[model samples]
Target: MPIRYALPNDADAMAEITCAAFAEFEDFDVTREQSAANWRRNLLAEAAERPRPHHTRIAELPDGTVIGLVKGGPADPGLGLDAEILALAIHPDHQRHGHGRALLRTVAADLCADGFGSLAIRVLAVNERARRFYTSLGGVLAGEVPPGEVFYAWPELAALL
Candidate 1:
């Protein structure tokens, strides 16, 4: 699995992967259309930010088809995070294939290089699969966020790598 920074041209594929991965999360409150729009906007905004948009990564197959994505960066104040995994998604067809784990490792390494001390992620308590996935990657339950989401953190990136 080759991982690369997502260019503007990759927005549609990224949106598709994200929407499909998140389709079951009705609690997220954003419609597919809204999510797509936000992805597009955020991609451009990330590019404009300093440090060059390393936060969004796209996973691709040998033939150049995108199959997964991970998005995050140094914490956003609105989200109350110092560093966070804003979103991670693998196409339904690509799940359980190590793409998710690779994404987490890649992102954690990036965050570490960027000088972040820890990385945070929020998962719905009801989403057992997600919780398991994060924990499997060494994510520690840091606390709980409102609306029934649990916050998990990986305080050290070396272990993740």
Candidate 2:
């Protein structure tokens, strides 16, 4: 899988992957149209952010089919992290193929190069597979948010690379 910076035109594909990925979670709820609109709005806002404080990357196969995406940005310093992964998703059809790992590593590398040392991500507490994945990648359980979300952190971003 090849990972690259996400473009505005990729929003629909990103939305598709996101919707498909999250649909597997019984508690997750969002329509594809809603997801697409959100991605479009966010991508536009990201384009206007001077110096690009955030990062979004897409994973695709040689045939140009998008399979996964990762979006991240500056985190609340209170979380003991300099950067945070806001979203990470791989299409249900593509899960367990390492596309998620590739996308994550790519974003971590970018953040590390940009001087972000530590990273964190919040996952739905019910997403056991995701929790295990983060743990396998060296993320430590840091804390939790009410109503069912947990934070995982990596003190060294380079460790992901």
Candidate 3:
């Protein structure tokens, strides 16, 4: 998997993939319409800044088609986390491969090198698949966030690196 910083042109495809990935989560008020709208807002907001609001990476195949994306950056003020992975979505057609893991490894490596000791990821409480995937990558259930969301933390970043 080739992972690289996302470019401006990738927003549409990224939004599509993101919406598709999240639309299956039944525990939210999110609708397909809301997801697309949110993606647009997020991409625009990030692009308007000098540096991106989040550190986002795109995973592409050999021929340059994006198959997955991962976004991480400084944790939210109240999270008490050193760093956070905001999103990780692999296209349905590309899921079950190692792309998601590869993206996570890339983010973890960078955050660790930057001296972050812990990394947090939030998953829907009912999203067992996502919870399992994070656990497989060494994420431990730390606590609950907002309604229907739980926080998973890599307390020992070294264990992941």
Candidate 4:
């Protein structure tokens, strides 16, 4: 699958990708409202209205089936702070193919060029596979990330020489 920035109309497919990825993992049971709000906030909104949600990407096969998705946004309200990968989901059939890393690198590279200095991502803490993936890419843990199993990420190398 070729990974690229996701378009707004891809919301439904993105949601499917999300459900598939989250279902197979042992992590927080994301609420339906939470998921619905995500598609609205991220996929439906335009860049001018919501910058973070606009920073989304998708991976699709030649047939145009979306197999993976990634979304990132501001670290918090009013800090000009940047964060990463609010969510990333790839179809199980497409896992372990460096698709996730490529999607992440694409977003981080954009943030770097935009002078973000640092980028953060959050992963379910109990999801060791997810955590290891982020750590391998150089993400550092913060706080406890709540719900007993969550971790935030910082993928960029700090302080460029």
The best candidate in terms of lDDT: 2
Give candidate 2's total backbone clashes: 0
Tens digits of lDDT, candidate 1, 1-161:
55453433567777788888877878766666777788889888887888753587778886778888888677655545468888889999999989888887887777778877767888888889999988888888888788789888876656778
lDDT of each: 0.78, 0.86, 0.77, 0.65
- Candidate 2 lDDT tens digits, 107-151: 888788778999999999999999999999999999997768999
The weakest ten consecutive residues by lDDT in model 2 span 1-10
TM-scores of the models, in the given order? 0.86, 0.92, 0.81, 0.78
Q: Provide the lDDT at 156 for model 3.
A: 73
Clashes of 4: 3
Residue-wise C-alpha lDDT for candidate 4, range 94-131, written one tens digit per residue: 88888888777766665565566666666666677887
RMSD of each candidate relative to the true structure? 2.5, 1.8, 2.8, 3.7
Give the best candidate by TM-score. Answer: 2
Q: Report the lDDT of model 1 for residue 10.
A: 69
Candidate 2 residue pairs in clash (backbone atoms < 3 Å): none
Query: lDDT score, residue 79, model 3?
Result: 73
TM-score of 1: 0.86
Ranking of predictions according to lDDT: 2, 1, 3, 4
C-alpha lDDT of candidate 3 relative to the true structure: 0.77
